[model samples]
Target: MKDRKYNTTEKQQTRKTIQRNVNSEKINSKENKANNEKVLDNKKILIISLVVVVTFITILIVTGVFDSGVQQNVTQMNTESQNSTVNMANMQEINNLENKIAANPEDMESTLHLAHLLQDSGLFEKAVTNYKNYLIKNPANADARVDMAICYYNLNDYNTAIAEMENALKYQPKHQIAHLNLGIVNLTARNMEASKEWFKKTVEIDPNSDAGKRAQELLTSH
Candidate 1:
């Protein structure tokens, strides 16, 4: 009976030991599972943070590029608008000049005025046509010839401009404006020596004249 009781006690202790081990194992398993979940959560947070940072950087880059393009487009549009306004004003003035010419084709004064206006407005080709017509009516108008030479110079016809200026000098030997303009044209053509000579001639023509003052300035600059 004592042996049987000792065996039963040993069996009970063994079962108790087994139960303790199983409980400990279950607790360890739960802890390990919780730890794994925490690690996974940390990894997910890191991945989300990287994605947010990359997306923000990309947005900044795209926004900067868009702003620069918008600014350039705005500047170009303003420039075009300003140019259009100026062109409209020039066209109106040209239309008025044409109307006057149409009304009185034989009026040399109006014709010459239109030519001068056209020249001042940078319409060199039209100015040249009108100037040629004026010269046809008044062949010996040295001033008109000089004005035509200026149109030629503006048109980049340097040789023809020089020839026309020389013809003006033939008609009026001491024309101060013609001499000054010759100096200017030669200076533009990079003929420094000829420019100096013409400027000197301008000064000699009339020291107190506006043309003379301009010539003196050019000479001083050189």
Candidate 2:
């Protein structure tokens, strides 16, 4: 009986050892599966991040926003360069005309050209001087008289402007430009009635002329 009791105790100890081993195996398996799932989630997150970065880069390239901005800057620079070049050329031409007038004081063409250039450059006093010198040589030149009148008007000499314009009309009664210039001078002097009369005369003389069109526009505006 003693031997049988010892054998039974040994068998019970063996069974407990086997059960402990099985439980340890099940816990290890659960741990391994959880680790694998975490690794898969990390890989998916990495892939999504890479895709978003690539898509953003592609959108920037496809839209051409950066390229268009560069092109616009280049075009603006080119336009400024061209304008500078043209201004330099115009100044050189003005210098040449001035030299011509200085050497030959009797050069009517050079005087007229310089006067026009000075007027365009806003040098009203210099333009008036040249115009007056040209007029002294050919007093009956209605166009030159009108040009001088415009110069006088720019110089704020309202009376001189009006007199010169009226003198231009004396040379040619149907001088549309003279009439238009007279109207403009009178308007500047606040003589609305006189201005209207000159404008009316300009329209009646030549309805299809540019001066007539300007007169009509002024009449309608007033």
Candidate 3:
């Protein structure tokens, strides 16, 4: 009887050990499952955050905020390229005219052409030299004198511009362009009264001409 009881007690202890191990495994499995779910939730949150960032960038692209700047840069580049091309062509023409005039120093036509080109190219001193050369033989050319006056005006020599314009008027008393340009030059030189007088003369010359209409506008505004 004592041996049987001892065996039964040993068996009971073994069963209790088994039961404890099974319960510990259940708790560990529950903890593992919870940890996996937490990891999945974190991954989902990260994916959603990435999606939000991508969507925001897409919206910005669609709104033209980025495209406008790119278009403006392209437009500016194209304009600069066109201006450079035009300058190159003008320089070539100037060189050709210079060569022609050098071969025939008395070529007043080439001299005037070169002067016009140089004035347009903003070489005021060189243009003045060519204009003086042309005027020495063609002093009665009111148009040429007016053009030279414009060169002086651009050089900021307001007094010389005025005198040149007046000389042009001496050749062509009704030179509307000369009068209008004198008004512009006087305005730049801060001689408002002289500017107004020139503008009035321009209008009196021909009220329907472009220069006269421009002078009229200036008189009304100033």
Query: Using Cα atoms with residue i matched to residue i, what is each candidate's TM-score against the true structure?
Result: 0.58, 0.65, 0.77
- Per-residue lDDT of 174-221 in model 2, one digit per residue for the tens? 899999888988998999999999999999999888999999999888
Selected candidate, larger TM-score, 1 vs 3: 3
Q: Please tell me which model should have the higher TM-score, number 1 or number 2.
A: 2
Candidate 2 TM-score over all chains jointly: 0.65
User: Which is the better candidate, 1 or 2, if ranked by lDDT?
Assistant: 1
Which prediction has more favorable lDDT, 1 or 3?
3
Model 1 Cα lDDT, one tens digit per residue, 80-99: 99988987887887788789
The segments of candidate 1 whose C-alpha lies over 4 angstroms from its true place after superposition are 1-87
- A best-first ranking of the candidates according to their TM-score comes to 3, 2, 1
TM-score of 1: 0.58
Candidate 3 C-alpha lDDT tens digits along 1-222: 999999999999999999999999999999999999999999999999999999998998999878998999999999999999989999999999999988999999999999999998899999999999999999999999999999998888999999999999999998899999999999999999999999999999999999999999999999
lDDT of 3 at 201: 95
Each prediction's whole-model lDDT (CA): 0.92, 0.90, 0.95
In terms of lDDT, model 2 sits at: 0.90
